[model samples]
Target: MNPVHDHRRLGRELDLFDTDPLMGAGLPYWLPDGAVVRHVLEEYVREVERAAGYRHVYSPVLGKRELYEISGHWDHYSDDMFPPMRLGGGEGEEVVLRPSLCPHHALIYRSRSHSYRELPLRIAELGGMYRSELSGVLGGLTRVRSIQLNDAHIFCTLEQVVEEARAALGLIRRAYDDLGIRASRYRLSLPGDGDGKYVPEPELWRRATALLEEVLDGVEYESVEGEAAFYGPKIDVQITDPAGRESTLSTVQIDFHQPERFDLHYIGPDGGKHRPVMVHRSIIGSVERLVAHLVEAHGGAFPVWLAPVQLVVLPVGDGQEERAHDVVRRAEARGVRAELSGPGHGTLGARVRAARLVPYQAVIGEREADAGCAAVRLRDGRRPGAVPVDELLERIGARDSDRGTELWAAA
Candidate 1:
């Protein structure tokens, strides 16, 4: 990885985010620019999940310790979890910050009974979760104590597992395609033979592993014997960064244990109750990690749709202030994230140089103002000349709408 494009450095240079030692390590403070990028990403993923028939919900970040105990996390994964906080003068139950959202989603699914017709119940949440990470390993947004996951659980019958898994895989593929990222390889993480980290149900493990293998039958994947979660087997989508360093960005996990542990059931068509298999999936994985990846992937120069500032309007002289403001207004009306740089802000040269931080810059001057246009300057040193205001707005609108990665890729 290029250290120059390291997210920690670019985050500071771009005024995107920061971390404070006063607030403890691994906690990020998102500045306005960074918040804009995060909001855009969250909304985009929300729409994607909505289109996929997923019901989004909000859940508390902390839950009673017994909840995780029933979900099997307390027995197998408590070290990574925050210590329990006792409430009510030591008379009440102990609560701990949840390490994941799957158990909470299982509770939501059990809140009401369902019929066999509603076999595939996809519940999603962009939920914030807290985990206890070692101070030595915490660096930038990639590894953090607090994480917001693009997590979802699909509760379906045994017969629907393959189809639901395929649908989940399709979502991951589509998301990666849109972001212009490719996975290096698929990894089927399974339980180790004698590792105490995994649950000890031979038959259940075998069935779940076989089901995942069948679902990914024709797909190419490497079997990772001891990397599975304590609850079940998972397919990890491993992405290789520009520097050739590989990391897991997404996952589709087959969980047969959580449902049974939580006693989640649905009424079958045969008038009998049956346990629904749970498929835990994440499209972009951790939102924070994805942001870090994108920042480094694009070197802090985000695309038109995801960029904090898509276009900067720079006034050549004080005389063009009114015209510059007018251009910003028009661009904003056209759904462009445009800003104006006036005389008092800096010199003309400095303003132009600052505009390099954004994708496109329009230098408005007396000549262009009189002609009802602005001189468009792209970051790649290409000048599209003084284009009409209407045409400029149209170009920007098209790029923003289409989520174009480069301003002049087509040109």
Candidate 2:
């Protein structure tokens, strides 16, 4: 019913990911081809987060309602959350599907008294979170009830806040650039009086917003008024799809109020207890939405780095099938996702056209195979003729590592 639905249709035609009535909607079943890309992207995010000085932590999918209440999320996030359940008899009788990974991480921090030296502690989680989305608004992976969020939270001292926020913004831009979505613009939202995601103290929220805005000032961003979460102000990155549709592809929100609400604090240099600021950010806000946006932006032809299948080796005849198998084996050995085009049968043109709907790199054939090469083709409609197998692999791998959209300079 929505243009987003049209995007979903393209996803199916390309064999990316899908949803169905049997699964009762909002539950996306990523096909094998789609999973490969999603899995790689998820891992890539994790690697970057770790390199950026964040520690990885795993937590439960469900938490007590009291937890949410204490964090202010229960009051604010209840409607969008899955229904709560009564825990027969627990320390605090409240259980709901985690809408976000913050409160849980905070609880982990409280597990032990933290000192000021550990003030700017960053925790990242690649989690599958569930929420209750109205069925009418659900469309494939874009707006789903169950989704994976590339979520991370940073608890830092006042002094470290600015640099931390700056680092997050950099990561956002780098990720987009890697995915070939560089033309996107970013928006920075600051808190107003009685506004921002509620910081327990007015001055704190005000000061935090100012600090973040100061760091973002030199950076190019469109400034917006009062669009931040109730707990803090934020920076959101958005891009336009082929039809000129704007979507917020990623976000980095800084929170000061929630941590204090949950009694989150660390011993400071003065040996006095002080509140730690919490930052809720997702470089890739929602993986499902990101995938959908990428699908539409590139019209379902992902780049080599992001493509599920990098190459499709097609044999000219049954005799060449052995060579094709060897070529495919070599490609896969080099971390390329390659497959034969229907074994001994199928026209190479038809297969290329079909695979074109997907993002693929090369197609090995009789001539190329005999010559120890593959017919290298770019998703951008360029046939670079037969390239040595090793050359093709190196080109594809290097482009992927460099986040280049194409094998040649234009890509």
Q: How many residue pairs clash in each candidate?
A: 0, 7
Q: Which runs of model 2 end up more than 4 angstroms from their true locations?
A: 1-5, 88-92, 190-201, 343-345, 357-367, 409-411
> What is the lDDT for 39 in model 2?
91
Angstrom error at residue 196, model 1? 2.2
* Residue pairs with clashing backbones, model 1: none
lDDT of 1 by residue, 207-312 (tens): 9889899989889999988889999999999976567777888999988899989999999989999999999999999988888888888777777788899889
- Per residue, candidate 2 scores C-alpha lDDT tens digits across 1-411 of 344436688888777787768988789898987898789889889988999999998898998878888888766567788988777765547688988888888898888898999768998998878889998998777789888889998989878878888888889878887887764677877545542234456676677678777778777888777666666778888777676767676777777777777788899889999988887778877888888877877667777778887777766667677877887788788887778785445576777777765444466556776788777776668878887888777776777778776567643
Please report the TM-score between candidate 1 and the true structure. Answer: 0.96
Q: What TM value does model 2 have?
A: 0.90
After the best TM-score superposition of candidate 2, give how far the Cα of residue 98 lies from its true spot, in angstroms.
Answer: 1.2
Model 1, residue 53: distance off in Å is 0.6
